[model samples]
Target: MNKVLLQWALFSFMFGLALSLPLAAIHYQKNSSFKGIFTNYRKLKSAHLDYFMQALSAAFVYLIGFAAHIEFAAYILIPFIFGVILNPTILLLEATPYIRSGWIRFIYRCLRATSPASLLFAWLAIAFLFLPTYMTIILLAVILISGIGILTFLIKRRSRNEVGVKITEIE
Candidate 1:
């Protein structure tokens, strides 16, 4: 098979495994049951962890595709991962109310739970898979700059929420 297709398969097989963790966590944590097919929530949870490792391995294999060039890798990975990203975003938002630690805990849980870095790395892998000429400096700049901006916004929001918590403690 060609590089992109090969990598896609690897990603689906292995990275798909690791991909299961955050998805499974969100699912099990949100729902007490998985339509009763699992019969045990613990099994459901363990299965998520299992998928997570597989996904990671798949991603590693997929990165090899970055060494070559493909016409539409970026568009492909983006659409492919859209639901993957959304699933956790929605799940985390749902758990915010139930989470006990407030903003800090919420942020921490999200950072741990969603795995944005992995997503970015997937993009980087996309970069690698494509021809080096196709991966422009501009694209790298955009990714890094956007990451910083988003990180800054999150930190500020969390700190602002924290001040309210401090005031409550004083009172």
Candidate 2:
């Protein structure tokens, strides 16, 4: 298995394990003061889960690549690592009130928006690296279709927002 990928998996797992202490404390209301640190329990729980899932995903990819005798480049692994780390981190930040508005919220949204693309690219790159040509083609087609759908949704949402702004300006 790729050492880097394995390391990331281990890191994610350990981080999740560490995070669970505070989560459990908050869940059981062990310390009322501790609960004040994280106002949103649900987001904290989600972040905890995301970390575990991301760890599993990293491990799964590493195992599959090892079994296929496919060696992944370090650069190709960047997106996966970025997504796995930042995705849960964003959730963790959301658990606090600091991410509610201003530049922090904008940055949070930017990170959130980019995470799906990073994950998709990482997985698709892995598929292309190991899978047969026919399977890779099929996967590429599906990804393209999904990308188009997401692009369309984003465009529509932007246009609606623009229209709303214009209407408010005219009033």
Candidate 3:
């Protein structure tokens, strides 16, 4: 039963990650233009609101899952802390490139180079709201696949980056 659940969760995570990736990249790149990818200021406001809402919704779901599993706080905390650590680097990776340079940017860029690390961060966030071990494994696999998609997407964007791509980061 646990294995079945695990497999099902894996499938769910993969499906969601696969579907979300392209759309997100498209939306993000389009939004990168400060005009802001909306018809007007009103739409831009709504768009940002939507992003926040989606993030919140995901968080709520994760918390509920953690509630279900109810593990020792530390077990959940450690990965989450790592996730937190990775997350800012991701934000910095995404945001820093827009400005600044030198060692900090380079360092952030290198850390940002960790493809699935972002996906792992998401999985860590969801880990708290987990079920049995099978569910956890499935979540991890989803994270794994998400990492794959990140590298795949990045390579597709710039062929030069393809040379250093890692094995585990591939789909």
Best by TM-score: 2
Local accuracy of candidate 2 as per-residue lDDT tens digits, 93-142: 88978788899888899998988779878887877777899998898798
lDDT of 1 by residue, 30-55 (tens): 76343333344444444444344434
lDDT at 126, model 1:
56
List the lowest-lDDT window of 10 residues for candidate 1: 83-92
Error of 3 at 64 (Å): 2.5
RMSD of each candidate? 10.7, 3.6, 13.3
Candidate with best lDDT:
2
Residue pairs in clash, model 3: 65-129, 65-130, 66-128, 66-129, 116-147
Q: Which scores greater on lDDT, model 2 or model 3?
A: 2
Clashing pairs in 2: none
Runs of candidate 1 with Cα error greater than 4 angstroms are 3-123, 129-135
Could you tell me the TM-score of candidate 3? 0.33
Flag regions of model 2 displaced more than 4 Å.
Answer: 101-110, 147-171
